[model samples]
Target chain A: MVTYIWVFFVIVGSFFTIFTGNVEALNNEILKGGADGLKLLSEMLPLLVLWTGIMQVAEDSKILELFSNLVRPFLCKLFPSLPKNHPALGYIASNICANALGLGSAATPFGLKAMECLQEDNPCKDTATEAMITFLVLNTGGVTIVPTTVIALRLMHGSANPSEIIITSILATLCSNVSGLIYDYFKRRKKHG
Target chain B: MANFLVPIFVLGIILYAFKQKVNIYESFLVGAKDGLVTTFKIAPAVIAMVFATNIFLNSHFLDFVFSYFTPFLEAVGIPNSILPMAMVRPISGTASLAIMSNIFELYGPDSFVGRLASNLQGCTDTTIYVLALYFSSIKVTKTKHALSAGLFADFVGIVAAFIITFLFFG
Candidate 1:
């Protein structure tokens, strides 16, 4: 899917630029894009390192487990197919908590771990299960409360009220999450009904 | 208030770790090392995405596409510069962030467009990227309804971001 999108971008972008007589700008972007990518990577590197390190403390100290226990009952209601004490639930809980706090780098590890656990019990190795689909929906909806990265960028740009959008972001993401879950629930019901 | 949230959260994690009798320094180093490996692993994807998105943006196709909606957008109070950001947001986070930053630079962050960009950025994750990565990690080729649900969520998020921003800051 992403393959098609990437190709579309490259082909259509080039054609459009040529047709629009912006071949010069196209040339510049193509020449500079790789460097831009690297620069972006560098900027993200330190933050990822620091947050993952802190998150590791959260994991090793069993804080994640405690957090998971706190959220497990609610999560079990969402992912009913899973066992009551599945390890995947713990990972999923940690992932969601990290994501809500806007620690995306930290969330990826737990997310991958959650997938690994889910794959262990998956009936079809090549197909996603209903629980997996539900998890993906919740994950993609991104119930972020802080949006730390956006605020950081706003601060970098010297915004007078860098964090002003936090409440609005939370509200918007809540709407996304609720609607996505509702859609997923109905689809799941239709599939296995 | 929001500015203090992250610092307080980080401190709480650290304090909790200490209370748990965890070796905070060693654990951090281990996780940080893993983070480095993960960064290297995802760098190729990030680079590829950035290269493609940069070309797409440089082509000004979004401007051409959005030109038709300029009058309507103006009437609705949506900035013309934000159309691409909202559209590309669920496809790529880095690309969206770049656009948000551009909006901030063009119109100060307090500006309505800047607030909209920030709300848009926080409204959803990169659906395609997350789906691709998570599914491939487990070798799941048949994604079923995950894509549709995720994209649906993104659509809702985008609309919600716009409406919420207008209500709050417009």
Candidate 2:
């Protein structure tokens, strides 16, 4: 799946730019791609490190277990295949909590940890499990409540009420999450049937 | 609120951990080491995805495709200027952010388009990027329905953003 997407990007992007008479920019991006990736990594690593460290404390102290226990009912419904208090559940809860707060990058470490825990139970190393897919659906659906980045940007741009769209953002995010979950549910049913 | 959430959350975790008699500093170092290892582990995948995505974005393919649909979209109250942001959103967050900033610059952040862009930014995550990163990190080559489901959610999010924006700000 990733193979096809990368190929499509390279082939289509190069051809389109060349045909559009902007080969220069495409050349620049291709060359700068790796550096940009590194720059992004450097920027992201700090938060991931900090959160992973902090969450590690949370995990070690069994704080995560307590937290996950609180949310187990809701998470169990979303991830029915997993045991009642799977280790991944705590990480999943942490990831969801971080994500919902709009600490977008800060959420990645917990999410990565969640994936690692989920992978432990994955029978086939190279294939995604249903639980993994469901978790990804929840993660990528962006169930943000504050939209700190957007609000901050608006604040920078001198808006009268930068956070006014908080309600609207929440509504839209709810729609996305609900819709994604519904789609995932249907696909799960079909696979079983 | 986000400003305070981090400190409060961190304090809560620390307090809990301390009460639990956990070796906080040692555990933190161990986890931080794991974080570093994991960061480097995924660096290659990050580079690969970023390379392809940057190429795609720099090509301005969405601009070309959206140009053809601008008239129709604008006729329905969707600003042509915001199309690139919406299209690039699920693909690349920074690209959408750049476009959103441009929109704010061009037509003040208080405008309907600006509000719509704000909603759009909040409504969906970068589905393609997140999918690639997560699955590739685990070396999962066969992602059956993750892509479709994530993109489906993004599509719904975009539409919802439009409706919610119009309802609230328009």
Which candidate ranks first by TM-score, i.e. highest? 2
CAPRI-style class, candidate 1: medium
What local lDDT score does residue B167 receive in model 1, on the 0 to 100 scale?
Answer: 94
Candidate 2 structure quality by residue, lDDT tens digits, A112-155: 99999999999999999999999999999988998999999999
Residue-wise C-alpha lDDT for candidate 1, range B1-170, written one tens digit per residue: 65576688779889998998988999999989976876676677767777887787678788899999999989987778798888888777877898899999998898989898999999999887788667766668787889999999999999999899889987
**Tens digit per residue, CA lDDT, model 2, B105-136:** 98888999999999999999999889889888
Error of 2 at B95 (Å): 0.7
Give the TM-score of each candidate: 0.82, 0.98
- For every candidate, give the share of true A-B contacts it also has: 0.81, 0.82
Model 2 chain A worst lDDT run, 10 consecutive residues: A43-52
Q: Please estimate how well model 2 matches the true structure, expressed as its whole-model Cα lDDT.
A: 0.91
Give the lowest summed-lDDT range of ten residues in model 2 chain B.
Answer: B74-83
Q: Measured by TM-score, how close is model 1 to the native structure?
A: 0.82
Which DockQ values do the candidates obtain, in the order shown? Answer: 0.60, 0.84
